[model samples]
Target: MKKLFYFLFVLGIVSCSTSSDDTLENQQNPTDLEPNKAFVYYMESPKVSSLQPSWYYTFNYKNGRLVKMIGKFVKSENIWSPDNFYSDSFTTLSYHNNKIELKFSNDTYPTIVYTMENDKPKKAELYNQFNELVTVKTYTYESGKIKIYSKTYTLETYYTYYLDSNNNLIKSEKLEKSGGLDKALTTTTYSNFDNSKNPFKKLYLLNDNFYEKSLSNNNYRKINYTIQNLQNPEYLPEIGNAEWTYQYDLNGQIVLHHPL
Candidate 1:
């Protein structure tokens, strides 16, 4: 079923990463998200119009590389203050010769090691706190955008990204492997983008939750399409078609966002 409406909030995805030769990574690696000093110091997840409990995170960069992320606080009803960080909210990044290692404050998570090409991931390896390998992730890129991501832990999840000529995301698909067949679970599409800069562009590996409109030329209209029954191989229900818009500041920055 396809569902659409005047979006109350847009979900921006900070996707995760893969492996390869790395002798020249330091020299060949593209610059990080912060360029031209257009730093997105602070970001609020679930940038919904209504007031509610939301996660707030602050970003830090060194030499243009995203080095750390700290979840400062959460909104509780009407009061906005810091009681404590939400669970597993602190993350640290390490840039190395071959890959970038991401460690979370929560001990339960494995360190995610990602290799890169042109600022996108090529391979990833996860290790437990005990330094034992937990799993390995891989990716496929076309035209500098990650086309396919394969993650295998207890179960396997595959994601495919489709981009337009402007290198903006057009759609994304979630696929699952079952019975030696790839089963598509969901598909999301983005459109009607304003010709402005996407502050979140090139900000890879910031968060695990990635959406189809996560990175684009500008904030765009998002329409999600779900298969009523992919196995049935027939028609799906119609989605509510609604138009959406966003307000941007004069500086071309999205006004919905705020500084840290």
Candidate 2:
């Protein structure tokens, strides 16, 4: 549950946000599916032929809070590397208080740092290989939606979210500002929740990251299917009309997700 996918869609490119840190003190306990270790197989699609190299992630916790994640890619039969293949992308994570930092073996910088308030994400800081600050994003919550503003040395963008009564994020809209002019970019919507589950809830709670808000106190609840609609397609054409199905383990963590 990297949450990389949703973060890619909504955040686009931005930095981090910061706010009060006691927001998550009363949050519900994590789901039974919480993983100390897991494997994720990357595939282009559900078809067997689309299976790609896999990744393994291990988590470490301190006083019941997730404090670290280690990830490494595992080569599959499709790879034709030499007898000894060396990967330059082994990743490591460090979590302290409400902040989580990521680093890769191939990177000279700390990659990214996420800061959370309560159980909600407030900011994210992106760094280059040299460890220099590249971008920052700040988030503010109003009503039931979260407003995000991202800034970099070169550009700035804004995004808004609309949530359902359950606090599950249902829609997102992106906007860009240039020379006092504001332009709409895209509007994305999600639907067909499975029961009361918001699939990525546990990831958000423990990882100190936020892409969507959940209303359920139980992280074990699962989203069995989801449909995404895009008002204006840009990079992801399939999102304009796509359906996704998720399968979970006995512990309630997702094991497989396929498009239908």
What is every candidate's alpha-carbon RMSD to the true fold? 15.6, 13.9
Model 2, C-alpha of 45: deviation from truth (Å): 9.3
Model 2 local distance difference test score: 0.51
In model 2, the worst 10-residue window by lDDT is: 42-51
In the range 1-260, model 1's lDDT, one tens digit per residue, is 12333232222221111223233334333532343222122233232333223444556766556677665333455446433446346778887755788887765654888886665677888878898877677888667355555555545667777778887887777766656565546666766777766656434575543334455656665455654345555666334322344456676655433333
Best by TM-score: 1
For model 2, residues 113-175, the per-residue Cα lDDT tens digits are: 878776666898889877789888898989877798887774677878777676665667676
User: How do the predictions measure up, each by TM-score?
Assistant: 0.65, 0.58
Query: Candidate 1's error at 20, in angstroms?
Result: 16
* Model 1 TM-score (2 dp): 0.65
C-alpha lDDT score of every prediction, in listed order: 0.56, 0.51
